[model samples]
Target chain A: SQTIHQWPATLVQPVGSPLSLECTVEGTSNPNLYWYRQAAGRGLQLLFYSVGIGQISSEVPQNLSASRPQDRQFILSSKKLLLSDSGFYLCAYERQGAPHEQFFGPGTRLTVL
Target chain B: QQQVKQSPQSLIVQKGGIPIINCAYENTAFDYFPWYQQFPGKGPALLIAIRPDVSEKKEGRFTISFNKSAKQFSLHIMDSQPGDSATYFCAASQITNFGNEKLTFGTGTRLTIIP
Candidate 1:
């Protein structure tokens, strides 16, 4: 079975600090990856998605950016974090041909103080 | 604009009671509808889904009922248990030639099943 993994299960960062969260998938190839943010009492917001290595699409404009350097490795980074950046960050994967069902990782809880 | 709208921001039901969550969409192009379950501090998981061609789909204790003409769908949990307490979200997507890559999700409903 395929599984998604994310690092830094929980993070607390000072304002203006750089941020880097990572996500990697195992047991699948050429899968689509996505990044989302969930604010308190708000719905999940799409931040970025990648089709393949070096191919990324931004769903919403933000200081955060995503990169896919390897087939199964995806990274979300920011040079400087803002208070608004605090939220629950999630990473999801959809099979290459089966896009309707998406599998999500454990997720990272980020608090920008 | 929000493409998918879900009602009853929160719901409370007794164990063994049936809890239904409803959702409606405005886009006719949408052909796929899915329901997801999320636990606190955890990512949402796919519970069940349905296509426009089918009026209903079921898996285990969960069921999805679709109304294409009404552009609405609902989730019905049978014999609900305390363990079923969590947040549920309804989403819709239009399958293009490439596939349904993007999903428009509803705000989500928080459910509590008390024993």
Candidate 2:
């Protein structure tokens, strides 16, 4: 069985501070990874996705960026966070085949003050 | 273009009732439709999915009905319970030649069940 892990489970960052969130998957290799953010009372928004290491596609332009440094390790980073950057961030992984089902990580709740 | 549209931004139902959420897509190329359930502060989980070739698929209390001609799909929850209260999202995707798939999600509907 494959599982995704993300940390820190909750974060509190001051405005204009640097931010980093990490996601790692176990029991799977070369899986598709995605980054999503959900604002309060809003739907999940796709931020970025990666097919392989060093390859990333960003969906919406925002203050955040994503990187796939390893086959199963993905990281979301920001040089300086904005108030709007505060939200619940999620990491997901899908198998490398047709009709793939996405498996989600525990997620991280970031609060910017 | 936003390919998927979902209805009933919020729904409130009593226990033992049924809750239905609808989604429509503009892309004909989408061959896979999936429904996801998300609780407060938790990541969304795949609830059920249906392919365009199939008209309907059911898993436990969750069901997905797909309409190929109309490019529409819906999720129905039977015997809704308080534990079933959550946000539900519909997604569409097409499989690439290389076998990679990317999903485009709907705005999502928040469902609440009263005791």
Candidate 3:
């Protein structure tokens, strides 16, 4: 069984506010999507990745941006948000040729006061 | 050189004692190596992986000791459990050119198994 969903589990924006984070995967199909960032103890940082539907690939370059708009959906955006942009935001998946098993989602705790 | 160096950021054992976490990497084209387990708000699981012709890899209580000419790698925890505490990550994989696969994380190791 596959399941991965992420949303406003926790968020408190401020300082130029504007950001959207959402990731969904119910039973898989296309797969291979990722966007990770964990700071506050620091480690995991990959920013963006996608392989189908509009395609997107970015690995650390700032303000944040990612969109797959359907085909399992995946979106992580920002029009303005900084204060280091806060922390803990992860969404991952893999299966397009395997890519060494990656499945995680259940995170999104951004607090940019 | 993608860099992946991790070690004793924090560790305290007691329940049966035996905790070791160490990682070292600097590209070398990185074949693949993974280890992750986080539990404090969640999201970071997949706690065993090794590939580089495999020097050692166990799956029960966790054990991975690989050294492809000292590119170094280690993670050992046996007889240890306080529910195994949390936070421990060490990853290195390179296969991107948009072909898929890319992960380089290691700046985490916060294991505490006191009971």
Candidate 4:
């Protein structure tokens, strides 16, 4: 069975602070990874997706950016955080040739103050 | 058409009652519809899904009713339980030679099961 792990389960950052969240998947190879944000009382919005290492696509323009340095490791980074950046961030993985079923990680809650 | 619309932003039902969540899409290119369930502070989980070729698909206590012509679909929860109280989202995607890489998610419907 495959498992997804995210670090810094919950974070509180001050404005203009740097941000880095990590996501790694185990038991899968060359999986498609995605980053999504969920605001309070709202649906999720896709921020970024990667097909392979160093191949990233931005779904929406934002202060956040995503990078895939390894086959199973993905990182979301920001040089300076904004108040609007506060939200629940989720990382998901899908099998390369499987159906569009997305398996999500536990998620990270970030509060920008 | 890249949007998936869901209605009844919130729903409340008694235990053992049936709760229905409806969703509609504008893109005929979408070939797959999926319903996800999310609890507080948790990631959304795939509850059930259906293909346009099938009218309906059921798994355990969850069911997805799809209408290809109408471009609509719905989720039916049988014998609803309090544990089922959570936010539900409906999504649609098109699968091509590349893959269904992106999914358009609806605004979401919050379901509450009163015990």
Q: Give the better candidate number (2 or 4) by lDDT.
A: 4
Rank the models by lDDT, top first: 1, 4, 3, 2
Model 3 error, position A30 (Å): 34
Write out the backbone clash pairs for model 2.
Answer: none
Better of 1 and 3 by TM-score: 1
Clashes in predicted model 1 = 0
Candidate 2 vs candidate 3: the TM-score winner is 2
lDDT of 2 by residue, B1-115 (tens): 6679998899999999999999999988887888899888788999888888999999999888888888888999999999999999999877655466778888889999999
The candidate maximizing DockQ is: 4
- Give stretches of model 4 more than 4 Å off: B96-100
Candidate 3 TM-score restricted to chain A: 0.33
Task: Give the CA lDDT, 0 to 100, for residue B13 in model 4.
Answer: 99
| All candidates: TM-score | 0.95, 0.93, 0.34, 0.95
Instruction: Indicate whether candidate 3 or candidate 4 has the larger lDDT.
Output: 4
lDDT of 4 by residue, B75-100 (tens): 99999999999999999876544454
Query: Chain A TM-score, candidate 2?
Result: 0.97
Candidate ranking (DockQ, best to worst): 4, 1, 2, 3
For each candidate, the DockQ is 0.66, 0.57, 0.29, 0.68
Candidate 4 per-residue C-alpha lDDT over A14-81 given as tens digits, one digit per residue, 9 for 90 to 100: 99999999999999899999899988656888888888899888989889999999999999999999
* i-RMSD values for every candidate model: 1.5, 1.9, 8.5, 1.5
How much is the lDDT of residue B50 in candidate 3? 94
